[model samples]
Target: MDQKIIKVITGQRRVGKSYLLFQLIRLIQEREPAANIIYINKEDLEFSFIKTAEDLNKYVLANKVEGTKTYVFIDEIQDIENFGTALRSLLLKEDLDLYCTGSNANLLSGDIAGHLSGRYVEIEVYSLAYPEFLAFHKLAENNKSLDKYLKYGGLPYLIHLELEDEVVFEYLKNIYSSIVYRDIINRYSVRNTTFLEQLVLFLAAHTGSIFSAKKISDFLKSQRVNMAPNQVQTYIQHLVNAFLIHKVARYDLVGKRLFEIGEKYYFENLGIRNGLWGYRLEDRGKIMENVVYNHLLFKGYKVQVGILGNKEVDFIAEKDGEKLYVQVALTINNPDTLEREFGNLKNIPDNYPKKVVTMETFSGNTVEGIEAQDLRSFLLA
Candidate 1:
């Protein structure tokens, strides 16, 4: 809601940043009919001439109407060389509101930080949440919709494609290739392409499990693939920087400390993970955990994998001093499974709400003072 600061939207490619920009533009136009708005999409071939700070400044000045505040929206501003210089030059103007979007984290890296000097605010955009996905596709809120969401995942464009297996698979495959080839490989000039592919597959296969770079390297060694732990670490960093995957650290509840080792990785989108692993249903438990992780993030919580003594809690979500201890599972039909999920939260002494989320229909039941809710209602809520 702070309109004064430069709004910089950053996220992975095709995660709906561009669409969000268009929505903002529509809102602004509806609010103020006579507003001066200059929209520039660097990816468009028509604006190919504006590739530098000076070109950007000249183009805006010439098109901007006088005696009115101008709103500038630039898509993929990082494509311009020294974009910070252009932004800084424009910031000196008294009546301009600037917004831009970028797919790479380097848009706000140290170099840009020095140039902008804390003048911009960033809004990180993500793919569609469950409610948004349901509303977008006009699907009913039922078990069938949830199953489709679990298999196809929530890439915005997927709603437009035919829901056939081959079509969805091919679309997801292309998205994965583009993210790797353009965002990671070409941008960073990564030489070990094969290793990068294998690393991504390994991470996708083990979405909710905890593992370190050394462990990954050792696993690869068994397959006759030679990779140093340091190299593996660097490659993983590249993936993180590209916003292709997220790494969550372990928080020890008893010790009140964070462990550097044994961190978990989750994909930015489930469709990408499914595409990488051929949509195999053999690991639904881990896949469901990944879904819960993303949902907690969508709800604006700072999430971490919780470690209470030696047992693992799926997620420790905290926001504005309100905390929720969550456990995710595919089902709690078996008594042993229910104990394992609810028992982990009981170990924690805090009175904050504890929850167990599963795919089972809600029986309106509580296990050992912890509420167990169905995943469908949780997602919509």
Candidate 2:
């Protein structure tokens, strides 16, 4: 908390970065009522005149109170031209503490980092977690809440709207379009937007499935889109850089190796995924696995897909030397499904905690030394 370096909070748009900055401002106000603080939001029309670094510096200097320590908070710093220069100039003042938020990866692009001389700490923010979602909606943790969470996801605005399906869908659609246009297309100057849109839909539909760029290209070719594998790979990288989707690599549990090919991609928010597919429930199991992957990330675990011999464990979550093996399923009612989920965890040699998470209502059971837990209970825990 006492670090003097500039703090950069970054994430996808509308993921609560601005709100978090406001919360920090409130905290500072409560702690030090006399503290001098300067808040500027680039999205506001009042700051439209402050486009260049000199303009920004002049504005801050003109507003800042002398003979006092000042904290500066700028939202969407990337909107200002040569923002790094302004930040660097401000860093020279010993009394100024600087923090900023940006929505896209361009905030940390090569030239910007070079300009800043690596004098900043980055804090990446994500959407709300399942437990946070429950708290936001004032709902008890249960199957119904979990179902709603899985379908709509943890985007904060959805909670604010009370999860009305139509309104949430429209909001998510707009957010998706803004990300695609501003972050991906405009930033990368992508020409074939149709192909990019198709790639997004393809990835959204096949979330949690293993496929390479060549495979995706072949699938698109079969659909008559005809994109080269190299091009597909580049587009996918853009999506990842924009923080719209995440790539999860496969880990060989037996050999302790990381595989480069055939990794799975998960959307940053399930609500956006549903918005892409019109809220279809065609692949419930895969969606369940994706949700579990995201939930593990929210818990601050470094997660990977585990491959042991020929079997695959859904997640290998580790944090601070503690390890957990998890398998996610829509249900374990069928004997084969139960074995498939639990048997894979049993193959691990060590005595690390193993769990199988499912949508089953009843809990408190074990299969082959692996705990079988309902998804709601697992998420809440």
Candidate 3:
């Protein structure tokens, strides 16, 4: 927040974007009361005074809110048409630092990017990581805590035990619907809402499996979920925009040719996936992978599902341009399974770090050119 000249926080809805904004603004105001601050939330229906760029401009001019320094806080800025223009206008006129929040990247893609080029920074705010999740729940770091996080997920509000399932999931669903309806459909004028929902649900159910657009399209066609290759891509993009799913392309480090065929899509919140799947025992491995990928992302690693020949790695992460390969399994229980997991990383070329993350609940160790750490240890560390 300090380094960003004009900060924009983007993530899935109810992932604490607005709350983080409120906290930052309160901190800024407490530290510098002399700084003129105007907080406007477009989602607030009471504020009918702000629906467009002209409305915002008229109000700002009428208020005579002149100052040497100004901090404009806009929440759900996508609701305002031409927000980029309005913000750019304000930034040009004064020593202003603009902070805005949105649930998706579309808010900053076309006009917003063009209008605010070289003048803005974007930060991603995801759901609570395991450590934060544990903090919120007053739970100690242990295997029991990891198991709970895997099941319930780390939505901050859900950390309060009293918050009923009916309430928390409802809130999360509304935010998801808003991103789909307002951000994706309304913004893009999409007509196939049914297909989009099916696509999201489909991806949620199959999070960690290697899939391709053609495979999905063919499956949909067989199930009467008919759509073209291009349409599948479009729906996938829309899901990505809503931060509901992320696609990890297969990158062969040895071959260096980015494969277009098979990839994996991860849901941003494991709890959301649980809600979609009704939390089954069969889904535990996926839930583990989901948690591991998110922890890496929260720690500032650009992560993706890794592909090495016929062997597969769960995640390939990069931090400060250095890479780490990871695999998450329920157990290396059988001798055959253990050998397969270790062998995949053993044959890889460079020593860029490798690990097998699991729910075994033991301390970390280096075994056969790769680190073996239990889920609890890996997360807490």
Judging by TM-score against the true structure, name the best candidate. Answer: 1
Local accuracy of candidate 1 as per-residue lDDT tens digits, 147-227: 778777888998789877789888988988988988789878999999999999999888888999899999999999999
Candidate 1, run of 10 with poorest lDDT: 109-118
User: Where in model 3 is the C-alpha error above 4 Å?
Assistant: 1-4, 61-64, 160-167, 363-365
Off by over 4 Å in 2: 106-118
Candidates' C-alpha lDDT:
0.87, 0.86, 0.79
Candidate 2's displacement at residue 119, Å, is 3.9
Q: What C-alpha lDDT, on a 0 to 100 scale, does residue 310 get in candidate 2?
A: 81
Error of 1 at 132 (Å): 1.3
- Candidate 2 per-residue lDDT over residues 1-381, each given as its tens digit: 435688999888899999999999999899999988899998899889989999989988988888988889999888788889888898888888899998777688753577776689888888888989989899887777877888788888776685777888888999999999988898789999999999999988888999999999999899899989999999998898788998888999878999988888998899899888856667888788888888888888889889998889888999999999998988888999987888888889899999888887665556667888877778788
Q: List TM-scores for all candidates, in order.
A: 0.94, 0.92, 0.93
Order the candidate numbers by TM-score, best to worst.
1, 3, 2
**Pairs of residues at least 3 apart in sequence or in different chains that clash in candidate 3:** none
Order of the predicted models by lDDT, top scorer first: 1, 2, 3
lDDT tens string, model 3, 3-74? 335688888877888898889889988998866777888778866669888887666555435556667788
Ranked by lDDT, the better of candidates 1 and 3 is 1
